[model samples]
Target chain A: EPEVTQTPSHQVTQMGQEVILRCVPISNHLYFYWYRQILGQKVEFLVSFYNNEISEKSEIFDDQFSVERPDGSNFTLKIRSTKLEDSAMYFCASTKGVSGGSSYEQYFGPGTRLTVT
Target chain B: AQSVTQPDIHITVSEGASLELRCNYSYGATPYLFWYVQSPGQGLQLLLKYFSGDTLVQGIKGFEAEFKRSQSSFNLRKPSVHWSDAAEYFCAVEDRGSTLGRLYFGRGTQLTVWP
Candidate 1:
């Protein structure tokens, strides 16, 4: 079963530094998403990307966050500046187009653990 | 303005005992509901989802969930739980009409299956 894959399983960075979390979604998937889960908190949606553009974003995805599909398979989330609160498990997910009335289930990657200090 | 509520923060059950996790949502129309599981330090895994007909949906790992539109709930259930079933379960919802496919997730219920 083709699954989403992310790089840098664990990352430690300074509080003010910039960081990029990379994901390679399933080859045929058209929609991609980024979600985060702070320790002991519910997974929160960050942003959704389609056609190489952002479709929607949450409040938490403020000025500091940006997503890019630099290549066909790579979907990357970039944080301009990190804060302690940015430390969390960042997950990447993707799914086929929403049609056919079939629920296009998003498949998640193993996640990249971001640790800011 | 959509949200999901998972009332139980943590639940414990003995091995081979039946299990059920409650989930409720606040949505105007028929919402797309989903259940996901996460083991400690792991990413989320889709357990099941409900889109339209046949309120009862079967999923992986011997799990099932029923969508009750009258109650605005989609609760996950299992005939018998194993020790390996211990994990954090999350309930999420997305408005069918929304184009972004952005999902709203609940706080989650941590299941502890005792041997």
Candidate 2:
């Protein structure tokens, strides 16, 4: 089965540095999303991207965060300034449809572990 | 605002034993419920989802979930769990009609299958 793929399985960056996490969603998927899981914490939604624009975002996705679909296959999340609290497992997910249809299942990638020091 | 609650933090069961993980949600309207599993250092894997129609939904890995609208719960169950079933389970909910759909996940429950 086709699955979402993320690059840089592990990322280590210094505080105040910029970091970009990349993901390649399923080829046919329309809706893409980013979520993060802090160590020992629940997975939290960061942002959702569709049609090259942000559909929804959480408080955690503040000024420092931005998402881009630079190409047809790549979806990237950029953090302007990294902090110690920014260290977490970042996951990318994609689904064929938006809502109330046959395709509601969101497939997730293996995730990229971000470690800030 | 929508939220999910997974009451159990950790559960231990012997191999070949039955397992059930509880999940409850707080949403104003009809909610789309889902169950996902995550192994160590891996991403979330969908087990099953309840969008509409049947209350009972069967998923992969010998897992199933029952959606109870009255109780606002969707609990995952496995008839016979093996040692490989040890992992973290999460329950998520999304609004049925929301345009900008985003899943709200629970804290998750860690299952440990003893041999």
Candidate 3:
């Protein structure tokens, strides 16, 4: 099966440094999303992207977070500044949108483990 | 707002035993429901999804789920579970009314299989 792929499986960064998590969603997917899970916590939605614009974002997706589809296959999430609480597993997901019949299942990536010290 | 609830925080079953994980959701109308599993240190793996048609939906890894609109529930069941099946299961829902594809996930239930 064609799956979403994320780069830098694990990352360690300083508290105030900026970090970019990269993801290459399925080639044909039109909708992309980013989610975060603090250790032992629920998977929280960060933002959803479509047509190069953000469709929706959660309260947690504040000023520090931004997502960009710089290229056809790359969807990247950048955190302007990191905090200790920012450490978590960041996941990238994509789906074929409603146009692809009824199969709107969002395929998830292995995830980028972001560790802020 | 759409939300998912996974009642059992943890479940333990012996190898070869039947397994069922409970999931409940609160939504205005029937929404897109899905079950995802995550092994330790791994990303989420979709197990099954329910989106109309046959109330019972079958998915990967020999797992199936039945959608019950009356109870507002989608429960995942496996006839037999192996040690490799141990993982954290998350129940997610998408509110088609708003937020086209944003998924709201439950806290998740950790499944532990004993040999």
Candidate 4:
């Protein structure tokens, strides 16, 4: 079975530095998403990307966050000037952009743990 | 605003005992519910999902979840759980009315299995 894969499983960065988390979604998937889970917190949606554009974003997805599908398979999330609170496990997910059938199921990657000190 | 509520914070069960994890959601439109499991320091693994048709949906790893519209609940159940079943479980709902596939996940329930 094809699955989503993320690079740099663990990252440590300074608070003021920028970080980029990379993900390679399933080849045929059309919709991609980014979610984050702070320790002891719920997984919150950051943003969704489709057609190489952001479809929707949550309040937490502020100016510091941006997503890009630079290539056919590569989807990335960049955080500029990270804060200490930004440390968390970031997950990348993708699914076929369809309403009915099994396309709605989102396959998640192993996740990249971001730690800002 | 869509949200998922997993009431129980933690649960413990002996090996071979039956298991059930509760989940509730508040959504305006038809809800697409799913249950996912995550072991310690591991990624989320989809256990099952409920789309349209039947209320009772079967998923991988001998797990099943029932969607009760009246209660706004989608609870996951297992007939008999093994020690390996101990993990954190999350219930999520797909936001089909708004975004392409943005998911709202619950706080999650931690399951501890005794051998």
List the candidate 4 regions with Cα displacement exceeding 4 Å.
Answer: none
The better candidate by lDDT, 1 or 2, is 2
TM-score result, candidate 1: 0.94
Q: A51-76, model 1: which lDDT tens digit per residue? A: 98888888999999999999888999
Count of clashes, each model: 0, 0, 0, 0
Docking class for candidate 4: medium
Per-residue C-alpha lDDT of model 3 across residues B1-115, encoded as one tens digit per residue? 7889999999999999999999999999768889999887666888888777899999999999999999999999999999999998999998685565678899999999999
Interface RMSD of 1: 2.1
TM values, all candidates: 0.94, 0.96, 0.93, 0.95
Worst 10 residues of 3 chain B by lDDT: B94-103
The segments of candidate 3 whose C-alpha lies over 4 angstroms from its true place after superposition are: A99-101
Tens-place lDDT per residue, model 4, B17-63, is 99999999999988988899999766788898888899999999999
Q: What DockQ, between 0 and 1, does each candidate earn?
A: 0.63, 0.71, 0.61, 0.72
Q: Candidate 2 lDDT, tens digit per residue, A4-111? A: 999899999999999999999999999999999999888899998889999888899999999999999999999999999999999999988757676668889999
Q: Write the per-residue lDDT of candidate 4 for residues A1-117, one digit (tens) a residue.
A: 788999889999999999999999999999999999998999999998899899999999999999999888899999999999999999999888575577567888989999999
Error of 4 at B39 (Å): 2.3
Candidate 2 chain B weakest lDDT stretch, 10 residues: B94-103
lDDT of 1 by residue, B28-73 (tens): 8778899999897666889988888899999999999999988989
Q: Give fnat, all candidates.
A: 0.66, 0.74, 0.64, 0.72
lDDT of 3 by residue, A35-85 (tens): 999988889999988899999899999999999999898999999999999
Docking class of 1: medium
User: In model 3, what is chain B's TM-score?
Assistant: 0.96
